[model samples]
Target: MASSNWISGIVVCTLIASCLFVVAGIIGIVLGPHILQSQVEKQLPLTADSDQLDSWSTPPVPIYLQFWLWECVNVGEVLRGAKPYVVQRGPFTYLEHRTKTGVYFNDNYTVTYRQPISYTFVPEKSALPETTRITMVNTPIVTIVALLRNQSAKTQEIFNIVKNFFNETLFIDHTAREWIWGYEDPLLKAAKSLPIIKDLVPDDHFGYFYGSNATDDGLYTVFTGEDHINQLNNINKWNGISSLPYWRTPWGNQINGTDGSWFPPLIGKDLQSIRLYLYSTDICRSLYAKFEKHSSVLDIPTELFSIPAEIFLNSTLNPDNIAFGTTDSGVLDVSVCRQGAPIYISLPHLLYAADRYQSRLEGIEPDAPIHRTIFEVEPHTGLVLSAQKRLQINVFLQPEHFIDDFKYISEVVLPAIWINESTTIDQKSADDLNNQVLRFFTIVRWVSIVLIPIGIVIFIVTIVLFKKHRSREESTPLLFAEANNTIASDHDH
Candidate 1:
């Protein structure tokens, strides 16, 4: 009896433990996603008290800026109305630094800030030294002449007189550093002496990114995510304007997107669930990206999102751009926002561009694989792992009948320089993500899947043990009773 009682007690305890395990497994399976979601929710909001504050104020990753300038090889042929030929020059790489300054938290669940940006030349990364000479079309002069299409003939004549006096050619020569940074030009100064040209351009010197370094682009107001998590990092206002007046349509002017550095959490996993928009102060418009393919970086799975080539296509192929009539494919006329300089933006070498652009120029090649902009994002954390932004600048050149040297050339776009901005997540941050977020998530998922089978197996074993003990007890009942009667008779005697 004592032995039976010990066995029965052990079986009962085992049965109870099995039941508890089964219940725990079920609970874990049911609540696993919610728990993971909750963990992500705590980190999504952009607040001063939040864990991302330091990184937000100053990006932890290194950003690089590279310029591939167009050097005209056949200026003589181009001037004589032959197909304009150009060759690509150096990839002048610079380490770009950014820091948020003049930050202010607003009461309306928004934060306003100005980002001070600077760039330092990285000699090791560049293809050529800063001293390499680049000869290309005089963009500023051409731009001014283009703008004078509607000006009085006297104004055009005045511009021509100045152009002649300065001995400015259809193309100008400058060193790589002067082309990328700033170089003084007498034409820029002499043009101001003309009454009509006085207010045309405020810049006295010209470069691809002149006045870009050590400057704040604009004031940005972004949501804090305290009120709505999806709105996190979305622009609320820029420079006190709700929308831009640059474009012709309301949709084009609408300023709704993140500032390219941050994105809303939890949506990176779903390609169709949401679209990502980036509002670039430089471009003065919001551009969207579509999920392209599954990819990985730093040994982690990621989603590759790329801006479609159609985004740069002009009026004919892209209906959204129809307001600007019959423009070249892969042309985005941001000239209205860029000091009315007839500057157009495009992909490097006009990839996905119409054939006309390529036919008009020599020594230009469009490689689809090399020039597309992409963002590799880790899905679960909704963090960007690597961002590569590429864009080319072109000047809208037309025959100015009123001005000499410009009259012989047909209307075309002169390729200037393409820029690439790249950045990747640091190793330390990737490690923290694995340790703090992914590891816990993986554990919960595995535990939920594992415990169910373990609990069921133990439960079945306990049931078998219980039946066997019951059968043994029933079979031995008569023997046990007889022994009890004998003991009672002895006591009576």
Candidate 2:
């Protein structure tokens, strides 16, 4: 009787435990995503007030800039009938201060924020000299002066007249120049005193000019005006009901989505292509950027690792050769992006352009992966954990029929230099995000997987044990009655 009672108690305990496990498993599977989403939503910056939004926002992140300068070592060689060559120089590092200035809601109730960005070169952190000179070899005015230096006095006078005409038409004097990174060579320097060239080049101070504090001078500045984010608020139609702007989806969050939405609250396995219209300080324009449809979903490690270069290459950010104004069939007019100069934008390693843009030049390794920009993003929070923003500055050089020396030069876009601005998440932030968020999800996933199977096994075992115990209990009474009857018959005999 005691053994039977103990068995009955064990079965009851097992059955109750099994039911609880099964219930927990089902709850996790069905409601886990909703619960997690709720937690994320609570942390979102939905309030219009700056202080409230700032409380939930991420702090300013540092961007480290490194410039790979290509020094024209063979300029003298070119003068001696040899093809010009360049040697790659230091990765000059600069610390860029980036921050979201403030948040406010527009008349349409769209949340908008200002990002104030500034940078200063850190000489101590760099591998190159603070003041290095690069010859302005490709500038039309400089090249024209060099070509006419040996001509007769009459030829030079005629060239001067032609140079002045071209300068006014091309806005050559007003063309943006980076004095910090480039300067005119001695040959071009002597020609600066010529009558036609006296007022062509702006004062040295003008070379350091950036636009008003909030804006940079370029064609794309129009896209990044005070009301930039408003342009991205595109209405999404769904099932005859207009949903909120594509940025704010049924998920109640903004994420890097299609052309209309370029921020993040990305969730699930939808590997759709996202478009971004970002203003480039270098190119001075707002570029139409898009990622390739097939992006690699990486399994990010807790520790820092090199990001794949293929990610940026596959993105359709770089303009195709057809983007240049070509008479060829099926060519697109990308002239709006050109600001008096042929603008060629590229990824860190010069990965995307056709033969016209010479990326595989000297100082660039044949297979150096470090030349490519790297990016590590926390998908859940939409935070950039680490990034290397690499871009090469290029100029499309075309021959001028008037200049004698230009006949020998092939029309191609020449790469001047590339810049890599890299940043990594500080240790403290990495630890907090990884330990608190990522690990929690991992633990919950594993626990749910384990509990369901264990619960089912325990429930089955409990049922089997209960059946055996009941059978034994039912047979006990029958056996006792049979024995009693046999004994009674013996007594009668």
Candidate 3:
């Protein structure tokens, strides 16, 4: 009887424990995502105060600009002066300042931030000559001369007088060897001389050639197109491709896009391609005004993908062609990039230029891939982990109707220089991301595999105990009745 009672108590305890565990497992399965999402929401940039917005939304990405200037080694010596050739020069490094501002939220949960123009600072002044100083002093003089020389025949006398006045008095610094990049050729020199009776040579200053005027205020806005919780598609509407931001998710927030980073928030495991649009800078706008296309996909290890710099270099996000700033028909508009200068944009090392353009150059590593723009991204979170932004500067050299020697030279798009700005996540941030993902996976594994199995075992044990207690009770009642009958028979005798 005591044994039966003990078994009955054990059955009841086991059953209760099993029920509790099952209930806990069900709750975890149903409510786990909600709880995790709530926690993540609290840490989101949308909820951050003004002071914390910069820290939370903006990543501390370091950008390095590597300049590969084209040096004219032998001015048409090998090409027989018919075609001037240039060689690649130093990979000079410049530190670039990058940050985000003007953060605001929309009613639909999308957030937009202004990606200011990056300020380029050379840590070592000796590394590269101050292009800014030279540009400021020379551009105004060049502009005045070009405008004066474009007058009608009736104004030729006035133009000549102004040209001579400017030429005799306005002598700019020639310290930075302009001919090395084909900026100060015979045509340019003749244009500088008043006797030639032509427009002034187009300004070769960086600002004049690259449309740096728009970048003066350095304000460019970028939208994340994500909800307050770092999830994608919260807004039911899809804007045109131009409205798309620099990142997106293939998966929604709950099952995907929940990665605690700025990009790729809801990437799926099976997706092969993704596209992001970045607001083109003025320089880029000269070629193609719309947002630049940044396409990537899952083609590498998650570990490497998590490293932004590595993936950016190795992935398809790198340019495969030179049509970045050109029209679909491959026509390059020189006037759009810079007013009078026939400047063109390209990737570093002349990677995407036509064969005719690249063939004239020497010292090019045949094996070295052209444009080395790269982006390391975390697939799960769709976050950019690291990146190397690269672009090349080129000038279109054509024979001027008035210039004598330029008529013999082949018209070509000459590479001036290229730059690469690279950035990566810091060690502390990387470690934190790893830890957070690991903890999430660990908890999921424990609840589904370990905790649920333990609950099932307790339920089975409860059932066995309950059956045993019932069997003992049934047998005990029969045995008691048989004993009483035996006692009654003895009394009758």
Candidate 4:
């Protein structure tokens, strides 16, 4: 019975030892990866949608203006008003396909179905003369993309019909393989007019074309239907995997590195001065080339506002190879005038960030309006005029997405920075409040990290002490027995 009891105790001890080892190993293995990932995420810079401005809203223009924007406002009139003088009448007709799917008037809605432009796509091409002074272009490139995903044929037919009916048409092609005029060499010679090219073929997946005719100094951008469709469909594949929905800014940037969005209020210095000018944009380069001339007032020492950065209005600037002109076939003029200036943007960044934010929200707030403001100085006149306008997106991100976007902004795309004179205690207080919330998770993460190893050490020490105590106890009994046996032997002798 004694032997059996001893054996049972030994077994139990062995089981306990084995269990401790296993538990410790599992804890380290499971918790290590998650903790490491959290640390890595923390170290990353502010990403795409992570900034607070992602959710900021502009004051809404009245409903009457919104209707007038699409109905009566003429692009030319707006352009001329801003230009300070009227320019000659342009050649190509201008029509705004404010809707994602261009609208077409047809007899029936079935069988030979024709889907007019919806609010989904916003293409920036020269508006057709037929619709000029009547409609405004406010659609997004993606909106047009959604329209032509599976309906390429109908899109083409509509393009042809609109051209025939209006005597001139400017439609971006879903797949423009060669230049629009590349194949129709003969037609060009005989035809009296040519369509404007707004967008260029980024990839050769499929041939697509978009035409514009707004002004000579406009850009035309093109997106292949297949390429765009594939990206839209497979965007989810990029989740958690780095480097998929890549984008470039007008400044030739692979990523937009805006540390924070509390852009400094322009004062004292030339609003034209560009400091911290991203090494990517043409304007940045153009300004930098003349950096030596502005050395006196070039916000010296801090280089923040050394040179003035000029973002020209779409109508005033020449965008031949890019998008957004009516006369030129280049890039799409997705540019928007909030008050009046062109809001140069990073398309891929906007799309991915917006999409990621929207996906999480699941359609709560589905549109993000882009706003642009311009400050102009006439030579020695110091400051002349400032104008701001809005860029409307058919779909805006939800409030939740906008808030959570900081994850991407802080971690992946751009980190926050205190630029120029935009910092104050009030703003810092708000940031501090947010940081407290963020720090809670950070503290918990760190505490768990420290406790895991400490727990393991404590477990090992307890096991060692218990083993030593057991050894001492076992030896004590044997020592007592030996002493008694020795004493008894001596007595017998």
Please tell me which predicted candidate would have the highest lDDT against the true structure: 1
- Give the candidates in order of lDDT, highest first: 1, 2, 3, 4
Better of 1 and 3 by lDDT: 1
Which lDDT values do the candidates have, in the order given?
Answer: 0.83, 0.47, 0.45, 0.26
In candidate 3, residue 183 scores what lDDT? 42
Q: Each candidate: how many clashes?
A: 0, 5, 15, 105
Summarize candidate 2's per-residue lDDT along 1-493 as a digit string, tens digits.
7987888788889999998998898888777766775565344334454332442233444567676655556554444444446565667676766454444444543444545555677888877665655553445443344445555667666665654554422112221124333434332453455665444333212222234224322111011111332232222211122322321124321221211112343445242444332333343222333333222223444212232333223214322322233322211222233323344555543554433344324333423366544344455544546655566655444544455444345554445566776766677656676676667666776787788999999999889878987998899999999999999999999
Candidate 3 global CA lDDT score: 0.45
Tell me the spans in candidate 1 whose CA falls farther than 4 Å from its real position. 1-13, 267-270, 323-326, 464-493
Which of candidates 1 and 2 reaches a greater lDDT? Answer: 1
The order by descending TM-score is 1, 2, 3, 4
The C-alpha stretches of model 2 lying farther than 4 A from their native spots are 1-20, 46-60, 111-113, 123-125, 132-262, 272-281, 284-324, 327-339, 359-368, 371-374, 399-410, 435-440, 482-493
lDDT of 4 by residue, 1-493 (tens): 5864785576567556655655655565556445544443332212223232122111111111111011212334322222111121112212222111221222221011111211111223222332333221222222222233344555534434433454331112211112111123221222223232112212212111122112121111111112221111011111122121222334332222211111221223443443322222211111111122221111111112222112222323433222233311111222232111122232111222333322322212212222221222211111111111212222211111111111121111110000011111233433443363334444555655665556566657656766786687689889999999999999999
> How does model 1 fare in lDDT?
0.83
Question: Tens-digit lDDT track for model 3 on 199-249?
Answer: 444542333224321133232223333343334322222222222221222
- Where's the lowest-lDDT run of ten residues in candidate 4? 411-420
Please list the residue runs of candidate 4 whose C-alpha ends up more than 4 Å from where it truly belongs after superposition.
Answer: 1-321, 324-436
TM-score of 3: 0.59
